[model samples]
Target: MMADLREMYTFEFMRYALTVGVFGGGMLAFLGIFVHLRRIVFLGAALPQITALGIALAIALHLPLLVGAVLGGLVGILLLSTSGKPGHLPTEGWVGLAYASGGSLAIVVLALSPHPDAGALRFFTGDVLGTNRAEALFAIAVAGFTALIFRLCWSKFVVSSFDPVMSQTLGLKVRRWNALLFLCLGFGLAAVMNSAGSMLAFGMLIGPPAAALMCFRAFPKVVVTTVVLGAGAAFVGLTASFLFDLPGGPTMATAALAPVLPAWIYRKIRK
Candidate 1:
């Protein structure tokens, strides 16, 4: 179990890759609680595609790729929160539009190139084994930011999640918090996409959190459980990919799903 990871740590690139995956896993697990509670599952796919379009546009314009991804995700976030208002469509419809348009743009841009697979893999699946030291430092910073956000809104976010109306009655500014949640989610989404690629980020964002919530009964317990499950999955997936010559993103998702299996089986037996 530890051999692959130990070997991975000896190399500078693999060390960073594992570091990024760990921080990325923790961050996603943290934010995913809010995402799931808010009933915003589609944000996983929508935000990533929007960032992918940003990457494509950056390639087209020769600007900073990360900037394009962040800006694109922010635009999508704005549309998600404010679209279909003032005599326009609904937020759901707006999200659908952005999802399609951004994903389409990315696909088109990638297809126009001579070799699309490598580019697609790098942008969507992530190169976890080849991550650099700088990227690892960036991941740590992002993880710290995630921790800060969670600390600031620990109580309010929990109250709002369980009962928005009661929170509002208590002068909790639920709407403002919800908006702020979306903004933090936007930043989290952007950060993970750059570090882990869209698919790994999306899976790690939802999968381990979902699994942990299914296992734990209390809020604080759920947070610890989710983070543990998420980081564990990342470690397992990284090792599996390295040993089996598998891709990083899908393997990480598979590892995440591993923890959910026992619960699912028990549910089936009870049913």
Candidate 2:
């Protein structure tokens, strides 16, 4: 088994997939902490579907799929930002609408393609092993940019998320900061979905953070733990996919859930 694993990395595609799985998983897990904390987990589901629709449209238009996915996700975030305001639809309603609309549009667009089934399957399951250097570099760039923004504005983000009233009292530009955070979230979602597809993106975004929250009380510790566990799951899942000839995205997503189930069970028993 060890020999097989070592030999797998000898292939560039395997290496690229592993690189994406690790870094992309960590990035998703990091942003996921904020998503869970803010009680807006629906973004995880909605944004990825939007991204998928974007990829589908890109395929139909013969454009760059990543660009389409990013644009779609950003548009979804913008619409979601207006949700829950007075006279506006609630966040949940917006998320549901986005998910439904995106999925439907993707299906319709893909049906017009020459190989609709293949395109549809790739959108649903992803092709992590088929990842190239360009996609990996793009993922790295997105992750790095997101980390820099969070590092510089960590305190402000925390204040806005945890205590919006206090943020208003402090004269913080709360709406602007929130918009920035949403932008970061949308970009990160697009990058990850490009490699891991929508389902796996949603899974990594929620599972590791939720599990870490169950095990740790401190915010910093939770962040660290979530990154470690998420990356580890990606590694394991990628390896398993190679060994078992399984789909990388779903396998990785399931691996992410592995820790979550045990953590949830333990927390429930203790409570």
Candidate 3:
């Protein structure tokens, strides 16, 4: 078993895949804390679909995939954030619209691509094994940058996120902080969705954090446990995919979500 596990990394592709899984998955999980705390879980769902639409457009137009993904995610965040006007369809209404249209349009656009590559559709279905070193490095860079920013401005983020009114009273730029948080979310989602697919990216965003919040009430512990679980899920899912010849992205998604049940059970029992 040990030899088999060690041999998995001997292959270059596997190394890249693992690196992406660990860093990207962990980052998404970390951002998920804010998603949950801010009560914008639906926004989390919507962004990935929108990001997928971006990838499809990129493929159809022969643009760079990463460019498409980042732009798409950023656009989605910007549009959604500015929504919820006095008489508009409400923020959730817009989120639902984006969530519904983004996924469907992605497929339609792909179908209409004049020259679709066979591997292009992997953006939706996921193709972690196809991840290259550059993408892996991108994942690491994004994760590291996210961590650094959050670390330096932890108080401002927490204040702005948990109590925007109070944050404003304190003379902090709440909107800027909110924008920065969403920017991080956009970049992190695009990076993960680029290689791991929207499904795994969303799973990592919601799952480990959900589970960790269930198990712990302390903020720091919740964050640490969430990151650990995210990374662990990636390792387990990749190993399982290798041994069982399963699809890498969905398998990792399943692993990321697996902790929810146990954590919920523990919460119930403790209650």
Candidate 4:
């Protein structure tokens, strides 16, 4: 098995896929902690769909797909944030609405396009194995940016998430912090959805963090464990896909669940 794995990485495409999966998976898992802790898992599901819609639109308009994706994700984030306030549509409702709308819009856009299969549509579902060096670099850059933001505002983000009132009491701009966090989430989703597809990206965003929460209570430990598990899942899943000739994105997503189920069951039994 080790020999096969080593031989597989001899190819440039395999190396690129592995690099993307590791960095992209780690970034998704790191951001997922906020989604899980804030009880906003729906965003994990919704934003990616919105980004897919953007990719479809970009294809139709002959624009850069990444630009379309980021714009679409940002629009979704803005809409959700605006309507998600108290005395408005609840966050889950907004997220559900966005998900459905985005999926429908993507289908409509593709159906109306002159060339539906212009190859960009693969991003909607994912094409992780097709990732090139440039996309991998973009993924790395986004991950680095996310890490910097988290490092600088770690306490503010945690405080804003756990206690908005406390954040305000401490003279923090709660809304600003929340917006920054959501922006980072949107950026990460857009960056990965192109390579990993919306579905796999969403899985990475939720699965590892969920598993980590089951295994640890300390915030730092949970964050570190989530990153490790996500990266590991991506690596294993990519290897399996190469060996079995399976779809890379879904394989990785399914692999991410491997550790989660056992950890969840253990936590339940302990409880």
- Candidate 1, residues 1-271, lDDT tens digits: the string is 5785676668776667778778877777777877787787776668778888877776666665567667877777776776667667766777788889888888687667454344444756676665667667767786887688778878887888779999988888987877767666666666666656777778877888787777666888889978887788888888888789898767876787677777666546766
The local distance difference test score of model 1 is 0.74
Q: Candidate 2: global Cα-lDDT?
A: 0.84
Report the lDDT tens digits of candidate 2 across residue range 36-152. Answer: 999988777888888888888777777777887788889889877777776778768888998898878887878886544344446577667767787788778888888888889
Off by over 4 Å in 2: 114-120
Backbone Cα, N, C clashes tallied per candidate: 1, 0, 0, 0
What TM-score against the true fold does each predicted structure earn? 0.87, 0.94, 0.99, 0.95
lDDT of 2 at 52: 84
| Residue-pair clashes, model 1 | 1
Model 3 residue-pair collision total: 0
Model 4 C-alpha lDDT per residue in residues 1-271, reported as the tens digit of each score: 8898889999998888888788888898899999999988887788898988987888788787778878988988888788768887787888899999998999899789775565666776566888888778878888898899899989989999999997899899999989988888888888778777887898899999999999899999999999999899999999999898898888998887788989989899989
| Reference-based lDDT, residue 244, model 3 | 97
Q: Is candidate 1 or candidate 3 better by TM-score?
A: 3
Query: Which of 1 and 4 is ahead in TM-score?
Result: 4
Candidate 4: residue 109 Cα off by (Å): 0.4
After the best TM-score superposition of candidate 2, give how far the Cα of residue 54 lies from its true spot, in angstroms.
1.0
Question: 17-50 in candidate 3: lDDT tens per residue?
Answer: 9999999999999999999989999999999999
RMSD of each: 2.8, 1.8, 0.7, 1.5
Q: For candidate 4, which ten residues in a row score worst on lDDT?
A: 115-124
Off by over 4 Å in 3: none
